[model samples]
Target: MEQSGNQNITDYDLIKGSIAGDPRIQEILYQRFAPKMYAICLRYAGNNDDAQDLLQEGFIKVFRNLEKFRNEGSFEGWLRRVFVNTSIEHYRRKVHLNSISEKEEVGIEDVSVSVLDQLAERDIVQLVQELSPGYRAVFNLYVIEGYSHKEIGEILGISEGTSKSQLARAKSILQKKVAEHLGVTRK
Candidate 1:
């Protein structure tokens, strides 16, 4: 137990302490990852209140499942997976994807895409937040999390085509919103 200080305590040590049910180490771990994880929660949530709820719920799951961690890959990655899954599951309980549009319009594939270079990260995230829940989920899963359409289909219980269609619609919707923000018409 190299408890020199919070900074000196490795993630392995923190996980072990959390597994042993030490409140102090759990607190340390929470303090360490909460900000980043909260950002993720916020992206999936409709607003800050839900983001806070997701954050608290995510930390609870992390501590409860601390013993199951195999220490295989980055612990942060594992923790992120847990948080993403938590958000997905929480969202699943709250909404259905039936309303996600099935229309896949042409021309988006050839779009230059450089318009985003002019925008800040906060601006883009705000645009993503403006999407419907299904569109938002597909966008985050495909773009931010780097999940393949097939994997998204499996996770979200939609068909692969549905996942792809939802992502396309989300992108189309975002493009329109961004164009509106910039006061330019889509080409």
Candidate 2:
């Protein structure tokens, strides 16, 4: 795992070196992916300290299970799944997903895409972070990670109805937050 004069080592080599316990290669692998992975963690964890913990836990899982990674897809894709699952596990431990009452499940108005398009990426992340854990998990899994409500229910140990409800609730709250951020009144 010695560094060649050129800094363009491939992921295959990095994986092999890391699996073989090469410290330099492990560090390189971590440096290459940590930033993007941390964003995933922050999206799920909603704060710096929890995100940091999830990131560390995710890398540990990544390194421990590196040998299980077949070369079928991009390494970063695999890494994303790991971090996202780690974040979900953390969420599960911290909060129990409960079904909202019928009275509380109001119809959600569609937030205009233009309002979302106007905000900075950080503002969007901040707004998402403000969501409660159940709402946040469902939103990230459904909207961000592209999981169906059924899949999200299986992952989060809730019913599919609950998953859909949580996502609707998350969107409703985010709609309000976006309007407030844009200083627009909702009729």
Candidate 3:
């Protein structure tokens, strides 16, 4: 291992050193990715305390499973998948997703792209944070993480229809919240 500082070390070297049980390398890897991972954790967790916990848990998973990475894709991408899965696992443990009835699923309005574009990213994240756990998981998985409904269903142990309904409900709620935040009526 290079005794040089983190600045000069490549990700490859960091991975190798971490796999070899080098505490310094593991810390460096955590420092490099924690901010972005924390953002993801916050998005799924919907609060700082849970986000912090998720971040720590995600890193533990990453370090424990570091040897499984085959280098076929970007390490950052792999790290993101791990954190997202960790967050989803946390959500599953805390919430039992109930499918919305057809009667309740009716009248879900889509938010305009223009309205969403008007808000800052932080504002958007805050709005998303207000979503219920099931809605939030479906929203993040389908919209942010780019998973298909079937994929989300499998990940969250729900039906594809349930995932679709959850996402629709999440969008509807967000639209209403955004409208209220901007002092605009949806009618």
RMSD (CA, angstroms), candidate 3: 2.7
Worst 10 residues of 3 by lDDT: 105-114
**Tens digit of per-residue lDDT, candidate 3, span 55-104:** 99999999999999999899999999999989999998898887677666
Q: Write the per-residue lDDT of candidate 1 for residues 1-187, one digit (tens) a residue.
A: 2235788888999999989989898888998888889899988998889999999999989988988899899999999999999999988999898553345433335223457777888888788788889989988998899999999999999988888777777877787888888899766
Collision pairs in model 1? none
Residue 64 shift from truth in candidate 1, angstroms: 0.6
Give the Å error, residue 132, model 1. Answer: 0.3
Model 1 TM-score, 2 decimals: 0.88
Candidates' TM-scores?
A: 0.88, 0.92, 0.91
- Cα lDDT tens digits, model 2, 1-187, are 3345326988999899999999988998988888999999999986989999999999999999999999989999999999999999999899987667655655543333457888999999999999999999999998899999999989999877777788877888888899999999989
Local accuracy by lDDT, each model: 0.85, 0.88, 0.88
RMSD after Cα superposition, model 1: 3.2
For candidate 3, give the lDDT of residue 54.
Answer: 99
